[model samples]
Target: MPIRRRLGYLPALVLIFFLCVLLYAFQLHSLISTSRSIDGIEQTADQLDNYKDEPPNKAQLKLQNSPLENEADTADKALLESPVQDWVKFVRLSDDIFLYSVILDLRDGNMDYPCVRIVAIVRRRQSITCNFAGNSSVAASFYELSENHGLSYGAFVLSCKIPQQIKPETVTSFIVQQDETKTYVNVQYTVTEKVPPSMPLTYGICIPVLYGSRYGAANLVEFMELNRIIGAGHVFIYLQHDRLSAEMIKVVNYYKAKRMLTTLEFKLPVSEQIIWYYGQLLAIQDCLYRNMGFAKYLAFQDLDELFVPYSSENIVSMLNPLFSANSSLASLRIPTRYIKASEEELAHPPLAMKLTMAAEAEDVLFTKCVVRPEMVFEQGIHHTSRVIQHHYQTVALPSSFGQLHHYKNYPSSVSNERVPKTYGKKFLARYEQVISELQVKS
Candidate 1:
């Protein structure tokens, strides 16, 4: 009886042991599966951390499905299909009037709506019709931009409000209609868009119309080198193509190839009726708007003029501190120091190093400006005509900082002084390099 009872107890113990082993195996399987799940979650988190700054492919997929992407596609399509207009030459609209460009002006603080400004050289006052997209038409208001120089034909900006139903960005072209002697003439102009967001250039030089045959390639090369040495990132020249020489064109093409110069072909429809230089203000307006969102600061002066710093190596170094100190500074009025070119120098133009004799600082009337283009509404040859007055101010820089070295022929009786030798050595080195390069190229 005792043996039989012991055998019954053994079987029961074996059954309990088997049940414990099964429970242990089940727990080990669950633990391994949970560990794998945790590892996967950590890997996913690491991937997110790696792409925190820049979105991953998944994010791009989301953007591709967004409404903003659709809008961008539509804008791109509209731009591609828009009619191509010649923006380089002045289009003849009538006998006495010519259109230069059509620009979307959104800088008006007082007006609630945007307007299209038609840049033209109008000899006489006349009413014109501006036709927009969707068959909308409005009478344009004329604003004369003469700086009181008393030229027969001057720059006029014909402004017409954009139709409320039409979007400004969608506007690619507009038609101008003028009634002349019971006959109507219609001319279409491509509209230049508003300012962009990215500014790639920090400093630029705007040279008014180069219309005379007197300027040679040598002097132009010297001027460009000098300005480049003094921190001119880009130079914009409005070339009256028919007026300039082949040598000048070659030099322009060389600089353009290097991406340092941009030339806009400029011509007058009726050159005899208008003084050639009188259209400088019009070129300035075009350049101002062209560089509005492209360059941070633009120097408005001729090829013969240069901004020379007193102590700093470049103009940017001298002005950076001032800008940092005064955020509202819109322009810097650099006093002019006239450097009289001798007869010999004029006959055979010498390098900037040879031209040292300069005049004392002149009054504000003879000053030129380096302006922040976005802050200026209307620019003049020597100053800004219209600026956002509420937040912007023009400061006249002292001679100690810098001066505009104007190299030209002056009367012998005028007092003379030596230009500060701040940049003479550096300019000489760079000028020599440029001469050597030109000689090699030739």
Candidate 2:
């Protein structure tokens, strides 16, 4: 009887085991279906994210394809495609040639013959070719500046006329080709119209390259203060970076921070071989073009020189009458009086007051000028080389009205006379105030 009962329980146990297996199988099938549903939802979300809407309306399309927008896109594309170059750095073409900048010449009267002028330091004999946009190439006309001082390398203005089919404003970059060499040089400076109808600055001064470590903080401070007192609103100084002293750099940075001065790094590809400041002519010409249509009046002088007004308080006060009197006057040639200052006097705070004795005005070796920049084409160290012909004239300023005081070391044989005392008191007062402000800032 016991054996039969044990056999009957085995069949029931087998039935329970089969039921459990069926329940587990059903749960696994439900989980697989849920996972497939989630994957399908994710696929739908991805399709919605990437779905494209209808095309834009006609008005929107017109705006997107406007002429101005197309032109801007063209310019942007050209710039992106061109090789990168620093605007202010010189681009070397040959062993003996270096190009500084290229400017679009669109002076009011000369729009018919629009051209681009390249300021360069190059050998006179080498021929240059200008390759413009659209693959058009032309020979460049070379006009050497007269103030090269017989150096092997000299300042030159290379000009090329714009093609009739091409618009002047659209030509942004060009390549230079030398006749003797096969290498083509890409001009670092982009051709653009820098001139505007009017500018905020009344007076601007351009100082040639300050090379060697001779000039220090004191020299810069005195120069800046005197110019400020005389109504110079802006000043540009070309600095030889490697040769400048750390103290001078600090002073330059200070004035730059005040927005009173702009210092450009000036270096020649052949600095070791060039004569004393041969690159200054290129620098001044660059400055002249840079100041055009900006400064009402621009003066060219060195750090040791100051233009003093005798009858008026500032340069503008003296210049207004001259401009009003002669409508055709483009520049004023100021007479210079060289004053000898001892080392002790130069080391003092106020250089103008301490160095009162000056050489006669007749002994001036070279005179400097204050010019209307738009009227002048090229500038030399002492005078303008070319002006807008027939429309402008350069006049000699009388000594009684004003003079440039050039502080330098002179021979003992030169006669020394006391400088005019007309503006001495005013200059001293302004100098003291400037010095105090500088001290406070430091």
lDDT of 2 by residue, 17-70 (tens): 999999999999999999999998786565444321112232222222213322
Worst 10 residues of 1 by lDDT: 71-80
- Model 2 superposed RMSD (Cα): 15.2
Q: How accurate locally, in lDDT, is each candidate?
A: 0.68, 0.69
lDDT of 1 by residue, 105-131 (tens): 666443223777767888887878878
